[model samples]
Target: MEPPGNATAADKADAVETRHRAVLRKFIVRARRVEEHSLAADKERLLAWARGTVTLKFEPQSGNSTMTWDLPEEESLDSLAARCRPFLLQGDPVYHGKVTNALGFFLRLAPDELRNYLREIRESWRPLDPGDRETIGYESRTGSISQALGDLVTDKELAYAWLYGDLVHADDNGEERLHGHDIDARFQAGALLITNVAVKAISTLNLARAAQSQNYLTLEDSVFTERVVARPKREVRVEKFATAPVGTPPAEIEAALDGVVPRPDSSKD
Candidate 1:
């Protein structure tokens, strides 16, 4: 995992762990055979849309692995952590304790601070008592605590880096690059939650309006005939896990999706 040009060697090393371990979830969004003009415009549009501090996990896919970004938002850590308490304490007490402990360790807060936070969490945990017999509702909020904690941590680190000018950068070389500011943030833990948030957010966006607003540039050279045929294909390949420590890399997750489902080879007649 080499860092992009313009990045320091230390930055590259930091990025390997930060990007690989911290990503919680990944989404693959693709548009095929769009007009070349539209494609170029779309790429720019996507980059602009992605800019800014939002609490989400995003990374553009390349050949082998993806470089994940932890978007920031204006939310306090305690508030966000409170939102996730119910989800953390839902089913089993033991599991809830484990989650709370993990979060405490990650936040580096004292026992007293953890207790105060848990007190606030307990105070706010009354909604589940209302007996709302809805499966979707439960699932929807099941990961709230984890999600909120993840968001707060990401935002906090990003905000600090932004203020101190300690953020890492990589050149945009027509490919994806990873940032390596917070190597110990455990982004992978929050990946799924942030991804869900991103999906819901994108669902409400008007892409057609975006397309219309951007001026598409034409190649003015290449042309395609009307009879061109495109084939739909899907394939799955499994490989042995020989990467970093288990659970340290994205591939260690039991539910993480890996590899490309290549499009079928096409033959011209």
Candidate 2:
């Protein structure tokens, strides 16, 4: 039969099904074996398997220290610290809680690094005692990172991290109480970019009149005109006529003026 056609279509399908079933059986068996092996293994082995695989070295420092990670060359330690500072100052309770918890996790993973950084921060910040409270009490009351930032940002306030600033006399015995710090602060208002257009309009007019009859009106017959006319036979008057050479409605003139003049926003002006 053509030597079984090398492998018939039906045979190929059967082979594929058999392989798939075999894989499923192997997976089932492996899972069971794993469960049994886990039960038989000692607590230490199981614990070791469950623990995180990555390892980071921690170098302790004296008094205060700086922990440098194997970071990219472009990144600076001060920049990293500054980035973390704002997160610690978030105002939302939820964000504050989450950041504090994450910091706790970092401490657990690298206690030496975290503690050293914290010590450095505390050393830089001044502590306050009840006896010295009067000196900077105003700052102590309202100088929070949140309040200071609010004054600058004009937006949502920031939360305070628990370990941000140091407390004085925290470990003192009876009568000596702990006092929080008053952080020295400065703020600058952002400049507003504004654009404005100014405009103005002006109009002018001239008029002339004429006298037609000397009997009705007189100009040259008057004593004031005697200097120019010299002598006049009789008191003469000449009729005067007047006509407007150019005229425009006051409202129309006002409307035209309005188009060229810039009106200020009364509220802001």
* Candidate 1 lDDT tens digits, 33-135: 2221121234443333234223444455643544444432323222222233223334533222333333333234334644465444433332222232321
Score candidate 2 by lDDT.
Answer: 0.25
Top candidate on lDDT is: 1
Give the TM-score (vs. native) of candidate 1. Answer: 0.16
TM-score for every candidate vs. truth?
0.16, 0.17
Clashes per candidate (backbone, < 3 Å): 8, 13
Lowest summed lDDT over 10 consecutive residues: which window, candidate 1? 23-32
Q: What is the C-alpha lDDT of each candidate?
A: 0.30, 0.25
